[model samples]
Target: MKNLRLERCGITQYDEIFYNLSYDELFRHETDAALPDSERGVVASSGAVAVDTGKFTGRSPKDKYVVNEETSRDKIWWGIGPVAPTTNNSDNQQISEETWYYLKDLCLKRLNGRKLYVVDGFCGTNEDSRMRIRLVTEIAWKAHFFKNMFIRPTAKELEGFVPDWTILDACKITCPEPQRHNLRTPVFVAFNMMERMTLIGGTWYGGEIKKGIFSVMNYFLPLKGMGSFHCSANMGRDGDTALFFGLSGTGKTTLSTDPKRLLIGDDEHGWDHDGIFNLEGGCYAKCIKLSPEKEPDIFKAIRRNALLENVVMDAKGVVDYSCDKKTENTRASYPIDHIERIVRPVSRGGHPSRIIFLTCDAYGVLPPVAKLTQDQAMYHFLSGYTAKVAGTELGITEPKATFSTCFGQAFLFLHPTRYANILGRKMEEHGSQAYLVNTGWIRGKYGEGERMDLASTRRIIDAILDGTLDEASFETMPIFNLQVPREIPGVDSGILNPRNVWKDKADYDKTCRKLAGMFMAHFNNFTDTEKGRALVAAGPQLDAEADAAYSSEA
Candidate 1:
């Protein structure tokens, strides 16, 4: 039976394979191997294992490919239809079946004579919607990472386990002569949906392993009339659920891992008729400059069975979370059980009562907290805007505007409007309210303005969760038409309206108008259906209001 399963996984030949080893067994194997070579990584003082990703510290989007076969040819969004191009347009690049077979054969040849590590796991927490997955790797630490990131099957549950999908991870090998092979680079991540398999090579970055499956779920779930989101979710004490949607560095993981609430999941989730379910069993949190004072839960959770990637450490195994010597994208991956406050036994929640769209607006023009009309919510959902600060990347000296459709464009399989439409129906069906919270600057743009204090952002979130801001007085902000509350209990009212804190009101208007115009231009990429048109129409009016204000001043 085991050989048959291996044959089914296209593993007809191998020197040896270790299947479904316990956590301690895998950890022992990994550490024993690493003892001789510290470069492979060592156990940190905190009991977490730290390793470095070679060649790349992040995902390679251009090298990611989707097979243009019968299963997903017409379904996948090939490109943004006829608008100004953006970075996200590189998503869902197509590859031929011939190319997939060539790469698959190369990877399997490399794995044939080697000792292999295989792990069996599940992705979705919802029993009905979950996908069974089998991951085969050449390294034990990556097997440990797969175990940490996915829902671990019980001893009895593994009795007759067969995977719904299989991933062959050949992380060390690279494709040769890319031009002849129809590849963007030597490093490639190709998903063949028809075969229910993914092949990864030439990069040791662990994110590619998890996100490869996430991209699959983003394709399959929506076809079943369910919603797959790249956002974080948590539940209040009273069973009220909330979701925080944002791209990286915009505080999605930071805000959702609330000490006061029970964390459902920190990264990806699914919404269906049965409510919300976590797509993974773990949290992958950014740890650059991480401190207990700011993020006590994440700080404390990074011990005993957690895995750290690309973090700097000393000879004594002391990790400096502040050091970016390796990369600013240093990360910690740990199971949800590591958290003190979490929904036990299950990582599921009821339908959301509120959805907060967090944006790090570097221009300092957006209000700290604003209630969003459903149309406005849909607009922002499709826009999915955030800002990348200076020093985060090379050549980014000032705040650079970044946008991802649904805040996860890189992982989406269908057109972005598909998910937006599903979210709209679900929110309306459940009567969920929406809010836009700016966690960026307050007084002026970037260098001139001060970043909003973490305490202030937390207080603003508390007001929303406690239902205190629902009945507060609100006024419409110009240019964007967002309804901003005049006051909150613990937050300074002076910063509530971003325009009020600015030293120069004219500069604020100019910056705000510039941002509004950027929104209008970027949103033009969508191929609008009637519903999409409504969402687009609900966005900021680039000229009418701002033009009227200028004329009135004249």
Candidate 2:
């Protein structure tokens, strides 16, 4: 059996062969090179990984491990060469389906029944150790998910960008067969590595290159996982549990590290039999020439173990930080392994006391923070309400409807109902609850439109933190259509009335007309769809209750 040889830390190094080779040459040798199969079929290159190929007497495909050597002093870090240019045969040069059949054998043959941690990444040794570690761990994760999946390392555009990754490692791991199982997600962490690959990623991605290629960086892992990345924290009441859900922009890292609460995990997380745990060692923040003032936490965290993303630089190559270039994907990705007290492999061991579903609402209608009920949680969860990402020159330009479970859609394999069922059951079982805090806006009276102040939102969150809202009396108020509380702390109870938050009484009527029209379009008018009809039916009753709750008694 071939064992992974590690050298003493800081003492050993690979032969440095990757340094001399041109990117083009390496791609040529790997992708263009061919091997013969016993079935008289020709195949593209095979994995250059070191393994015990002899132990595999198995005949099926399954989950396997692709090791990312971050701490091994003895392991060799092989640098990757540039991608070979697509030629007359680019499309013709796909890896044979049978290749996956072989890949399945490789992964299962190697890591079956062995508790392992597979790191995922782009190209391990293409540039520096920072980049390598990120890419490796990402690869490990992807490899772990798809037993027979063969990952090709490249940052070039093929299909799209993959972000549905978690430094989510396993505990009692076992790979039975890499048999043909339909994988819906990609093990995405690199630039378009999952581009051509459909399942685990998306089609739109970053254009600017980091280091050299747009591979995933190792610095994204939180330090808690015990790696060498940065820019993360672990905060909550006991520091044992916390919520880690957010959109691409709205300060996921910023708020998660509030000095008040201990940080949990970022990027990738898994709900296991025990609890939830993070897979990586650091953090990955989006930066396009970021400055300390704009992102001070991340700025400070980018030290020895950090890998800067597609950041634009000045003549001196220093980051500008203020520039918002839609053209560039200035990013800062790290591994959770960098954090010191990271919660590992967060299993769905139990329900969370508080489940905060974050949003980046551009319409800004609701308050930044308002508590929601369990049913409301489910409602909003199904609503998957989020504004369309402001489309870029290359993407959509307006806010659109995006509803996803918890808030991620990239790598989810199961139907959203699966997560919903889990959350509902767990919340009920644990007596923990769900809340819908509209971190979006406030509708004032008459034509005077008003936006909720962020400070007030913070205060609201603060109140939630101290349990002041819970102690206060809550009377369920209703919106005309939805069962929203008329009075939520840090929120105006008037929105319960259709007339509130509009420019004029006329506007209120117009708005209701619009909402009803939208509803009718979606089958709200049908009595046959009782479930759908019930939603609208719950409207007025919910509004009255909410109004009573908000009509505070001094």
Candidate 3:
């Protein structure tokens, strides 16, 4: 098998190529590049190397594309396209095979005569299911990022390392002509599944590289009948494993890195008949407004060799974690081993005993914590409901409801139902309980209500993990039909039920119905099949009488 062959990808020229450098070596090169003259990066007070992503600080979903060739054209879930533009509305936008090749040649030419840093690593920790990946980039920090984020090979393993897939990240390059290439923007993240290659340009956001591989695994794992998840997993001392599913800003990484429990993985995982395994070797945690008091595990992980992206620093190079002047998506990338508690050697665990679906409900209409039936688990999984407040996105003054199917629509390749089916079957087979925990607000919407305290949420999560909540009495919530616990050990009973804490009960009822309607409308995007209809019933309902009765009961 060929190993580290850039020539095979049609590039004959490069200044220098370094392969699998140690963290110290990469850090030396990174700091050198950040010299006074070069605007690359600097060492922060915490000893982490901090760099700015310039224009793009987050993943660009719209610019992402998949080559609609014979191998994947029929299999990909290319959802409906826009009426006027003639492109899919989904994140997996379609690009012709010809256009993909055109961009490939451009990417190759841009790397010519430029220094390249190549790193070889594994994606999944399970040797049986993991994919050997090679990342070739021009930036030393990016090479470091890939090394920190992926499972590093040992000295013996690196001898014959051949990547199952490869990513060519030309962070400093962009297409010269979007009109001629028939592209939306000069920046493009085009993937050709048949070729087992991904081409990235115009964005230095390291997440694009990390998540691009995840999309590859999402496609392949499902084909192998294994479940790929955009969630966090950890194991308790009692041998109980739990998975946390949610979108960004919703505590997936923060909550799952429990000090008491052994963290299996923080971001992504895969589940098969055997069990679940961590997909990546590291944690890419959002560190905006990060504090040691709130998140002890993640805070301490930011030490020497950790990579901080787009985080603001003062004149003396001390990091201001609360500053969002650059972007609200300030992040820190560090290997999982940085944490004090974790599953050693291999990050794999038994079938999860419980699954928690986390959502930051800015509207504050949903109960703080609610239990779900198996069907409801699949329904909520498909819905993947979460809300974004004013500052989270570009142009939001109010809380906007966002639903990314399966909590990771951006990375999914197959239909949403395919993944939902696998989850439902696995849950039924293993008897895994599901719960939805809202960490957003308490009394009212974003403007009026206070955010849920981290301590209280942790207490609620502890109850679920320790099996205390299972014995507590549950009451049905209106419209959503979620079963809320009557009382939690450390949590106030008044805040357990959302309506009880709301200042205006009638306004609460109105908001609940509006959110329910949004859920129903969003579910319409899914195909109308027998299973689809069944899962639909598991979601929220809007009945006038039910709302009135629920208001009076509160």
Score each candidate by Cα lDDT: 0.86, 0.35, 0.87
Rank the candidate models, highest lDDT first: 3, 1, 2
The predictions' CA RMSDs to the true structure, in order, are 2.5, 16.0, 2.6
Candidate 1, pairs of clashing residues: none
Residue-level lDDT of model 3, residues 44-107, one tens digit each, is 9888999888799999987888888999897887844311242323677778888889889888
Between prediction 1 and prediction 3, which has the larger lDDT?
3
**Model 3 ranges with Cα > 4 A deviation:** 1-3, 33-39, 79-89, 391-398, 544-548, 551-554
TM-score-superior candidate, 2 or 3: 3
Where does model 1 exceed 4 Å of error? 1-4, 34-39, 80-90, 391-397, 550-554
TM-scores, all models, native as reference: 0.95, 0.52, 0.94
Order the candidates by TM-score, highest first — what do you get? 1, 3, 2
Q: TM-score of model 1 relative to the true fold? A: 0.95
The alpha-carbon root-mean-square deviation between model 3 and the true structure, to one decimal in Å, is: 2.6
